[model samples]
Target: MHSQQQGWAEQQDALAEFGQFALSCIDLDLILQRACELVARGLQTPIAKIMQTIPESDELLIRAAVGLPRDIATTGVTKVPGGHGSAAGYTLVEGEPIVSHIPTETRFQVSEVVRRADVVVSANVVIGATGEAFGTLEVDSLAERTFTQADISFLQNYANLLAAALDRHKAHRERVANAEERSILLRELQHRTQNDLAIITSMLRMEARRAKRSETRRRLESVGHRVEALSLVYRRLYVTGVTDAVNLSAYLDELVKRRFLMHGLEHDDAVKLDLHLTPVEVDHSQAVAVGLIVNELVTNCLKYAFPLRQGTVTVTLERVEPGKARLTVADDGIGMPDDQVRGHGIGLELTPVLAKMASGDFTLEQRDAGTAGHLVFYIPDLRGGGSKPL
Candidate 1:
């Protein structure tokens, strides 16, 4: 009874020491090393060791040890035997405490490791979130000494603590991996953007040099307007830290102002642009479509919407219903006949194909009082859902 009580007291003291050390602001490796040393001293044993299981090889490896050669203390790679296995292996397989008054002959251990030791017993405790066996708490004494139930229970609690630490280390590694992948993707996007910019710059140079008259030069300047619009989209995509939806209103305002400036149209010019648009969110595919459509419409308006001197162009865009939009490009200028309208711009034909691919409706209508074009189009939600008529 006295021995049992004394052992209990020692166990409590050891547990308290471990708790204090765990709470201390120390390195993780240092804390684990200290725990192994303390276990040997508290138990009055010749050897005390902590072993961790390697995931890939399914072998037990000693992480820290005391009262052994430096090389022996660091080595604990033990594989399961084809026949019967050691106490440590049995402890892990059965999830039960195993105690034996027998010597463990291991190829992983050197002769000098346990020369002064008589019987070396180990208590295996399952560690980690899924309760898989992680390692063992082993101790050896010069004389044969049976470990009590209380000793096994104390070691089990420590094993749980070690399991939590191992999980934290795993999580840290996953975060680092994710960060590296994101960096690689960002580099690839930048390379693609650079290539696209080079192509646009070449096209603008070629077009500018080929213009023969003031009217031709003014028409070619619209290409610069379109390129600047694309550049703005890319810039905002990077600046806002998003590759998704852009503020349509802001983009259009900036785009129109730049186009007017490129054609030498001052801010207080006779030409007035009235823009009325509802809020809309679009993915890259839709954004690209809308950008090209705007370029074509704006180019036509600048060329023939006004009598090169003065006029008003009202552009109204609205989401009439879910996945349905109505766009009207109207100008108080010389009206066009139905036959002339069909051959207005070749790009208008692509609108119907793109709309069909999106599972939407596309219609072109000519309004009276001006050469007005109404684009009634239904665009399916980029995310999901059926298309709606515009």
Candidate 2:
């Protein structure tokens, strides 16, 4: 009775240790190795191994083992052929644990390692969380030994724990792959959209050039510029590989340079650019609205503020507070009249509306030399809100 009680106590201790190991382990290879080691120690077996099923070929490859020859464990003896006779193969196919006296068993061919090791007893259990088996967990002894029903039950429980861990790892791998695929598709879509916008901008330019009336030509040119501003946002997204937020500093720099080049004033010494931009990240829809506002303000300065085409336009973006940003577009040229600033021209009318779309406030003020337009808005915290629709 004392011997029986001592055996029970040891079994309980082994189970407690295994539970702790399983809880702490995250890597599949580590878990498998530890499980095999623990099983070998608890069962007093000469060999304990885990064989993983290869889904493509329906073969069992030895993944982890203890008390097995290095060559047999690591090299050419890796795979166990799947069929009716092999103990591991049968356990996987039948989805049940089996214990057999290897010397007398004839239903299936024993593995070469088992034969060479002179193993007398072999036991195998299916390892899987669901009904479908993933592989087999096997234990063998060189001395003749009989495993009772309790022993078989204990091994099956261990196999079930392994199966659960494997299933979790498989799920995580799938999620990572799915996220990558989505990112690729989003980039492709942005590229195609930018191409379409470029085509439209070209068509608008053609129409503006053909117009005979000065007023009609100017209106067409303005519309073309607005479309081009929208196009620039998509271009920035493509170049930066960022789908969630726009890097304000890089984006505005490119935008200002492109605008000067478009107006045939990139090399003009009189027209200078003064940029004092800080790094900031803004959501997609907000970025588009800000881009349009900047385009309108800069276009106004180019056409009206600097009549001599020989002045400076300054663009500034700065984070004013924890969740706030301010953008300023100022020029050192002819100032706007109070009445025109209040009037409903394209620049004046659209600037305030676009500011509202960005959830910002807009203000126009006459500086000592030219006009300054200010836009202040709330920026989403990095920990939360992502891009929202315009």
Candidate 3:
């Protein structure tokens, strides 16, 4: 009775050790090896092995083993027929534990690994999960031995642990593969969108060149620039392969550079840009709104801010406080007179509405140097599905 109790305690300890390791690990072969190692110690046996059924075949391969020859255990070429002949095959066929004296066994044949290792006794149980039989885990002893009912029960439970670990590892692998596939598809779609936007911008530029009146030409050209600005956002998304958020700092920098290139202006143009920006990450929805507002403010300044002499348009985006940010576009040129709209009035009028879309407010005033527009907004929470402005 005392020996039986001690054996049960050892089994419990073995299960606990293997269970913790299995839960935290994702490697199937490593789990199997550890399971074999633990069961042998739990049962006070000299050798243990785990055989896995070959896919769509009636053959069990020696997937992992302990206390066995290096050639037979690690080479993965040892195969046991999945029939009533060998101990592993019999347990797999009958879906039951086996206690056998292999030296004088008549009910089943002896496998080569066991025969060569001089194994005389073995205890085996089927490894299975939810009507799926995976394989068998067996503990073998070189000396003559008799396995009790407690030994059989412990082996069965240990095999069940192996089956559960295999299922979990398979699920994790599938999730990783699925995420990679989705990322690839998203990048391809974004690439196609960039191509289409470029085509549209080209068409708009053609129409602008064909216009007769200066005002009509300028309006068409502004439309083209707007499309080009939006294209930069998508281009960034495609390059980064991240659709959930946008790096606002990089996008704005690119936008400013494109504007400089569009007007055929050098670094020392009559209206130069002085950008004071900080890194900011916002969700896609917030990024689009901010991008449009910045484009409009900068375009207005370039067209109407520096009319008399050389001046600089300063653009700034800074995190003012937690959950709040400010974007300022100021110029050192002629200030607005009597709250008059600057560039065609459309951009300035739409500015307030765009700011609202981003959960922000827009304000324009005559500063000491030139007209300054301020957009102050609450950053969205982006953590744990809260609004994220992180």
Report the number of the highest-lDDT candidate.
3
lDDT of 2 at 105: 86
Q: Identify the candidate with maximal TM-score.
A: 3
How well does candidate 2 score on lDDT at residue 119? 82
Tens digit of per-residue lDDT, candidate 2, span 102-130: 88887788877677667889899989842
- In terms of TM-score, how similar is model 2 to the real structure? 0.82
Candidate 2 residue runs with Cα over 4 Å from true position: 1-47, 56-58, 73-77, 117-121, 141-154, 337-340, 382-390
Candidate 2, backbone clash total: 1
Each prediction's TM-score versus the true structure: 0.52, 0.82, 0.88
Residue pairs with clashing backbones, model 2: 85-108
After TM-score superposition, the amount by which residue 289's alpha carbon in candidate 3 deviates from its true location, in angstroms, is: 1.9
Global Cα RMSD, each model: 10.7, 4.2, 3.1
Q: Which ten residues in a row have the lowest lDDT in candidate 3?
A: 381-390
lDDT (10s digit) by residue, model 3, range 1-390: 898889899999999999999999888878888998899999999899888888888778988888988865563677877777579888877777888888788887887777888898988888885247788898998897878887888888888888888888889999979987987888898899899999999998999899999999988888887788778888888877776777677788888877877766678777678898887777776787888888887787777676764788888999999989899988888866554555336667777778888889988878777888898988765565432232
Using lDDT, rank the candidates from best to worst: 3, 2, 1
Candidate 3 Cα outliers beyond 4 Å, as residue runs: 1-6, 75-77, 336-344, 378-390
The lDDT per prediction is 0.60, 0.81, 0.82
Tens digit per residue, CA lDDT, model 1, 1-390:
997788677867876777677665246577667767767766767677666666765445666667765644454442332112444544555565555555654423322333433445544455543256556666666575667777767767666666665566556668778966875676468456746865785687577779778666654555565565666666655555445455554555666666666556775888777788776555545555566556556656666656655877677778877777776667776644454468544545555665554344555556555666555566545444221111
